[model samples]
Target: MANGFEAAMRMMRSRDPQRAEDGFGLLRDRAAEYLPALIEEFENEQADRGLRSWLLELIGLAESAEALPVLAAQLNSQDEMLRDWAVAGLTRLDTREARTALWRARANGTIA
Candidate 1:
């Protein structure tokens, strides 16, 4: 399954929509179990911006409390796309911490 997971990750980075969708389906199904790995990849893998963004999306979609800090930190990202995803993630989470972070970002003018 780990090998399958790795393959799916590679497929997720593919330019082909079908491949990416298949990969996304597999990862999304196992997101909770793979949340830590996804976060690790997002944090440490600096080579592929697209891959990192995908990882962030999956992390956000997981909707776990563990994803709070990762999403919140991205609110300060210079990358507007990442910031947008962060806001979306936090909004989707709707936890106390997530809301607090959103409020702080609003107060700081990090978001609208």
Candidate 2:
């Protein structure tokens, strides 16, 4: 299982579509345990832009409560992609906290 996480990280970072899909499958299944690291990577500004976006998308797909803070933070990002992914993640979460965050963002005109 430990190695699976490493392999998934490597695969998801790959440019190949099939490899990334397989990696995403593995990562998604282990989201509860791996979300923190994934969120950390997503927060790395020095990371590759495409990889950062991909990481954000994966973080949204995980839908873990642990990811709420990061997802909510991204809601106000200047980057449209990040904001969109954050909204999707929050919607996926659908928890009271997530919904509240979304509501606040909407009220603030951060989202439509």
Candidate 3:
């Protein structure tokens, strides 16, 4: 993870709404640089559902190609909102693999 990212993660994880909100903005601003760190956080199973969802949203906003795999994986998630965020990220990426995954997910019942 890059410098300041850990702090941003802490802010994102903060229970206080204000801190979390600010952290989300910071994550969006550093979306590209924070891609790997955010992906790592998303991969952690210890997070509650809400935090996982927030991380997904952050990754989508980052719009990094590296996140395609992660977003594609989320297409199969049972959580509809998670799937939506994955689709959103894939669309933002607009790469061949990401677009193909989006199409496949849409056709295969992953994306609604």
Best by lDDT: 1
Q: Pairs clashing in candidate 2?
A: none
On a 0 to 100 scale, what is the lDDT of residue 71 in model 2? 92
Alpha-carbon runs more than 4 Å astray in model 1: none
TM-scores, all models, native as reference: 0.89, 0.83, 0.91
45-96: candidate 1 lDDT, tens digit per residue = 7877777777888888888999999999999998888888899888989999
Q: Compared with the true structure, what per-residue lDDT tens digits does model 3 show for residues 17-99? A: 89988888878877888788888999984547877888998898887788988999999998888998888888888999998
Q: The CA-based lDDT of model 1 is what?
A: 0.88
Instruction: Tell me how far the alpha carbon of residue 53 in candidate 3 is from the true structure, in angstroms, after superposition.
Output: 1.2
The list of candidate 3 runs beyond 4 A from truth reads none
lDDT of 3: 0.85
